[model samples]
Target chain A: MQRPQELRNLFRLPLPRSFQLGSFPLRSHLRWILIRIVIKTFCGLTNTSIQSLERNKVASRFEVFALRLPPRIQPFDLYEAILKTNFRFKQNDIVIVSSKFVSISEGAVVQIDKIRVSHKAKVTAKKFQMDEKLTELVLREADQVYGGIPGFLLCKKNGMLCPNAGIDKSNIPRGYAVLYPHLPFESADKLRLNFINNNRLKLFVVISDSRLMPGRLGTTGIAIAVSGFKPVIDHRGEQDLFGNILRVTMRAVADGLASVGVALMGEGRESTPVVVVRGFEVNEEDRKMNWQDLAIDPLEDIYIRSFKSK
Target chain B: MQRPQELRNLFRLPLPRSFQLGSFPLRSHLRWILIRIVIKTFCGLTNTSIQSLERNKVASRFEVFALRLPPRIQPFDLYEAILKTNFRFKQNDIVIVSSKFVSISEGAVVQIDKIRVSHKAKVTAKKFQMDEKLTELVLREADQVYGGIPGFLLCKKNGMLCPNAGIDKSNIPRGYAVLYPHLPFESADKLRLNFINNNRLKLFVVISDSRLMPGRLGTTGIAIAVSGFKPVIDHRGEQDLFGNILRVTMRAVADGLASVGVALMGEGRESTPVVVVRGFEVNEEDRKMNWQDLAIDPLEDIYIRSFKSK
Candidate 1:
């Protein structure tokens, strides 16, 4: 029953100021916008070897870059950087990084050989009349795989959706597999703390990845994990200059910004993995971002939120 | 895996060679950096109705009358006069509008009794655990009523996330309700075509609404529908200045621009519905907008793209 005017009294907290990104020049500043204005990026990778030494070496190599940013800037690790570099970031600073790197660093990547092929993966593969190469492996590693949709396979381990069975091939040298970050939100929290303690500034962090949208021709970044951020920006109760209060106004700021930021960074070759954003006209104060922020409760989500399957 | 490269690509689409906006205080035409910016203000007539309408003729009462012009020696509404009065609009030229008027003209506003509940609504009411008084009526008009995760009841019809069980109580008559434009995209297309054909210019139309996000504070404008514009600018697989090929990069040009454009117009008592955006350097080729462009498919989505609830 409430419209824009009624929204005035509903705030559990203050609204984050809006950003004036258009004020910046489009040429050189575009990347700056992606990095500085960008938020997070996620990725999944397969490995040449799952050896602990290699893993540590890769983490260490990433660490090398992490230590290189201005101490004012968050460290390179998405989690640690956000937590440690909070001060350098502002209320609307963008924390852009890849999820593949995060997953690899957190040891989410698992050995594909160790997974046990399940009877279901075997049977379901037959039922869908599809290949068992990947499904067989999924059956072994998955706690439960649902037979609902395509492009994504549900695993029993966690309520996560990833491509190639959440197994990556990017950073992984040749044959090894990887999983998601072991403690995603924890990682984000750690990074959140890092930024908070390092500097007196309030900041947020996002662990993101480059992903495909089922029916679209392009891929954008999505936050796998986040802290000190609001995933969606609502505008349900507000007015325009025309004396008209708007209805049904909400923006998926995280995803929307992630997509733009990631696009500025390029998909595979560009490794400018860190984006530090500042100067937003709107945003949260001390709020922490979580899965709920990026995801619609289905209550607020309209299209994909509900469905009728045959 | 990718991000946006240089905006030199803004020229990729057929676009004007040059443009500018706003007027400089001293400079006759270069001062504001804000030309054709429509400032809109809203009032609820349900509280005052005919009385308010008596004072509410928009074109006459709400138009910018007393504002001072920097130095442009001209009779005002130059932009509006040309766009609205002359009914001339071009391609690639960006038009910012209020969704409300579009809704009103489209007959989106309706009487509450006109609604009908559904069986799913009953199940949803119980699932959402809502008060019985509201539940009975909610079920009728609700296209689908879903179970709540814990403490919320969700009712959806047409995939729009609305409250008051989707009943609105503002501006319109108290006994009536306003539904979302039956086919917003269609409405946008029709208007877009009129402007394009008449003005013979590359034009982009953005239908805006001011509303709240379920979990956040404050509200901003959102593009409910767009026509003749590239809503999203993707940069996946592009190279950054750092020579790294960005993995997942895409920019929500429309949404970002919308957020910023709405902010530039300033909120409240400023009643200006149409914002004429100029100086933005982009292209305008295909002048038709499809709702699908604004949505992401699950297959390519990172979250549930390949996942089912466990």
Candidate 2:
């Protein structure tokens, strides 16, 4: 072809909703483009008044909830949050759970003053090529310091790749750090199951963190863990009219969904820690999906093998 | 914290225009949006018409072109087509070799009567679980019948994933089938290097094939391979302000770009085999891109990879 035809718009598919995209260095309209996002916020004094909404109750489609749990809320609060949010809170057309909140709820956080790193952690740290000072910090009882190339420091306690080694500086003073939510999968399961039993909505719960992609402008969340959404689209034993059988390709629709969700969730603002998105079309058969369905193995990660986040 | 704060206007840098998605499933606007794209198509074509458009001649923004080559096309006709299509003709804008014509120019077509089969291919055919009758017919000098799962039957040769292994009944009509264009990557490279050296415009050349995605509707063109575009984004040593250092993660920007380009290219129908997308940016370090970049190592694949995309 000397000059090729511009082949855009060859088919029909609806474009996403428009929103202010702040994450990319490039202009992105991927955020706020979906009309079904549900958000919860704590603004006025009414924040204290917002109680955990109960289960199976009807709530607004577009809700902004404020939750006040006991200090160091328990996993039960995770359920309560959903109940209240979805009851009078109503299920989000789409729901988002903050990684920090999930970690804290599951007691994923560690009080630096209270922690005592283990001997094993220290040795593992060294073997992984971690810094001595950081290793010393971990030896004092870190869950796991991220293990990777020399320059990059993933979380020491959790496998998470966030700043502070999966430490949380949020919901706490600057001096203290938080850890990833413990038993995130369990936490995810409970909420997902409860949503199914109660609200009758297909909920996609993701254990998301502010992941750092090197060279990219901002933290677009990776679905570190997820459930409910059908994660993969499998096309095996099928042929084109032309008859070529497709081999080994499944769309990572969940990650793209999570990426879009995180994009919509915005990078740590909107005080809507958890967002509920609605109006997406999916069937009952797709509910309560597995985390593995959505997870891209670290090895298969094209970007992962090639680059490391420091 | 119950709800994270909603972050507004997070970009310190301006968003690039590439991410400005007007809509998803862009099928509706195909008829009209095409007009805006035609302008781009003309620009790319006019620049490369008749002969290689020289580098730096009209190389500021990314432009699109439609080139109908020589042999099948007359130089005079191309020159006239260029002027009528657009006023510019530079070598810088070409993104890939046109495959349809490549097959024609290479003359890889073969008569059905004269053929030979590889024992390896025959064994492989049985491995595909083809029917005995067809298998017997195919065994007549055919290397193998390449398709089977359910209802698909394909020719034993030709590298295409078509009903007849991309073997054609139309192009030949009487009794011949076209093989895949030979040394296709070589043709792609010549066009690529020519753009790089002659027009000097930053470009990538992809020799594409229409492929089917499992579980999704319709086919999209995929790059057999590519050069010039930064195929992958390696995010090593990167940290979000959250401070999580990433050990592995790279964005397959080129492949995704190709997928989107296919969406824009619209398979064989547009005959706009080469798509010149502007404003799509990537880290420039790895300019010599690879097809390997797109292949998720089998181990990392999660499906089939009972564990991952293994």
Candidate 3:
């Protein structure tokens, strides 16, 4: 399919009304060329250091396509549907699936009304000023609740620091909450194998979720599980532009990719459950890596250290 | 200017040796189609809930083009050079410029040898085992030095928590360090005005820098300054998918875009100093927003509360 033209048209939409170029008397196309020429001439006269613009093409280009799947679909079925898309998968293509999708597929949804609230959960709910049923669910899912403000519970679940153990109450049936997928690494591996066996393509799969950064206003992307790629790219011994060896520059490549994916996949009614990230380079040797490769030691975490005094 | 064809060829490169399809008997194209058919058929038989894949068009798409500029170019000159490119800007189009380029343009580079080191700098160098000259520079730039590890000084700079006050020693001339641009919001405004006057186009400009996130292994992008767009999109009081009013879901849209830009403009040898982000929606009223709009009150920050006991 001629997808590039469609992609190009996507970016060629008209500018907003406030930025219209109608102020120029000449036609838009001719005026744009004239403006470009005048700007180049002016720059040439003003800045002697200004040289010819290099046509050095972008070394890596990433195109994110959010694939919408039916609600409550199974994981294997969702994989098959994605494979059936017109967009073909190539080697090293990273398919980032939202953890919510995986959890729904894995039957991780909990009926809040079905839960038996404990005395501790009720007391904690009263103290936190939260719903009793929600507190019971949070208590069951959380490995440790560090406490929170009136409306939330800051906790650790599955070795991850999150609010309410990543129990999301959005986009599910009424009175039901979605849980983070259990054994996400296993789920990623299963999806990877499905892709390989069916399409004969080697692809990286990342199960992603959004989490709030400390002191940041909104949530950024985080990788819960990964398969067929190195989660971190260490640049400790790599030389910088000044020829200085970088000491603490290990890049969380997967997490960054997940952030890009999540940004494209809006948290609200976007319905974009799957995002295809192409053109990223991944190490072949690290194909067997899993979630542990992306996790940080809680004891060594700087934020955890700050909380130590408390 | 047939860029789309060029882009298509870029992704069509041969797969890696480990993932090559030469082992398969059938041709690559035919085998892929066959595999797709087989998967669809198998899925249909096994999963009754499997439905047709919906071709729900992507609501928003972003393409990042890394434009290469000469080293040590001035800010206005850099903006003029960007205007000289074939790609045209429109309303709400985001132009992300690296902070290093802005610093160099603003004459924020300081020669380390020119600094007169103080007794406190010497003591700090001895205690932290860093160069006295660099320590002096950090001391000058840092508003409050919280503490440090062996090599890094954790400090608050310009109302942001950063390391060494975002003083970078890489990608500059020898014996010099690049300081974060003075009044980044002002610089962003200047660039925005340049775009408006030259191309007669409205553009959102983001001055970006890389910073380490706590508990994360690598750096993510942060927006130091922005012009021509709202930095945050408040989703508070909006109904979620489950029809529950969202209490705290304000998104830091500019910061996420910066992260996307930095990921493309890699920290290492990739000389992409500017990235053009096209196809994002921005609020018209937010065009006049400054840095303060994106900042949170330190007293109200949850992380600050955790650190208070220390």
Question: Largest TM-score belongs to which candidate?
Answer: 3
Report interface Cα RMSD per prediction.
18.9, 18.1, 7.9
Q: Cα RMSD (Å) between model 3 and the true structure? A: 12.5
**Candidate 3 — which pairs collide?**
none
Q: Which tens-of-lDDT digit does each residue in A1-310 have in candidate 2?
A: 2211111121122433323334333232222111111111112111111211211111111112222223343334677654543222334344557676777666655445554556764665566565444444544434443344443344333333333355444444433455556656667777787877876855666666544333222343444556655544554555422344444434444343344344333332223356443333332334454434544333333223222211
- DockQ per candidate: 0.08, 0.03, 0.18
Q: What local lDDT does model 1 show for residue A5?
A: 26
For all candidates, what are the clash counts? 149, 112, 0
lDDT of 2 at A197: 88
Provide chain B's TM-score, model 1: 0.56
Error of 2 at B142 (Å): 30
Residue-level error in angstroms, candidate 2, position A235: 1.5
Please give the range of 10 consecutive residues that has the lowest summed lDDT in model 1 chain A: A58-67
Q: TM-score each candidate.
A: 0.49, 0.39, 0.77
For A1-310, candidate 1 gives per-residue lDDT tens digits of: 2122222233232322233335543443333233221211111111111111222211110000111122121114555533433222344455655565566556555554555667776666665544455566555556445443443454433333344445444444334455555656777677667666766656666676555433333444556666676655554577633335754445555554444345344334434455543333336535554555555432243223332210
Alpha-carbon runs more than 4 Å astray in model 1? A1-92, A104-120, A126-144, A155-178, A192-201, A209-222, A230-277, A281-310, B1-101, B105-107, B113-174, B190-203, B206-224, B230-310
Q: Is the docking of candidate 1 incorrect, acceptable, medium or high quality?
A: incorrect
Native-contact recovery for every candidate? 0.11, 0.00, 0.30
Best candidate, lDDT: 3
The true-versus-predicted C-alpha distance at residue B283 of model 3, in Å, is 3.1
Q: What's the C-alpha lDDT at position A87 in model 3?
A: 54
- The digit string of per-residue lDDT tens for model 3 on A1-310 reads 1122332244354533433444535555543333333333334321111112322333445555566655563334657656655454667788999998889878888889999999999998898788999999999998877767666777767666667888988777678888978888888898998988888988898998877665566777878888887777777777766676666776777777788787777766667788877666776544565445776644456555533523
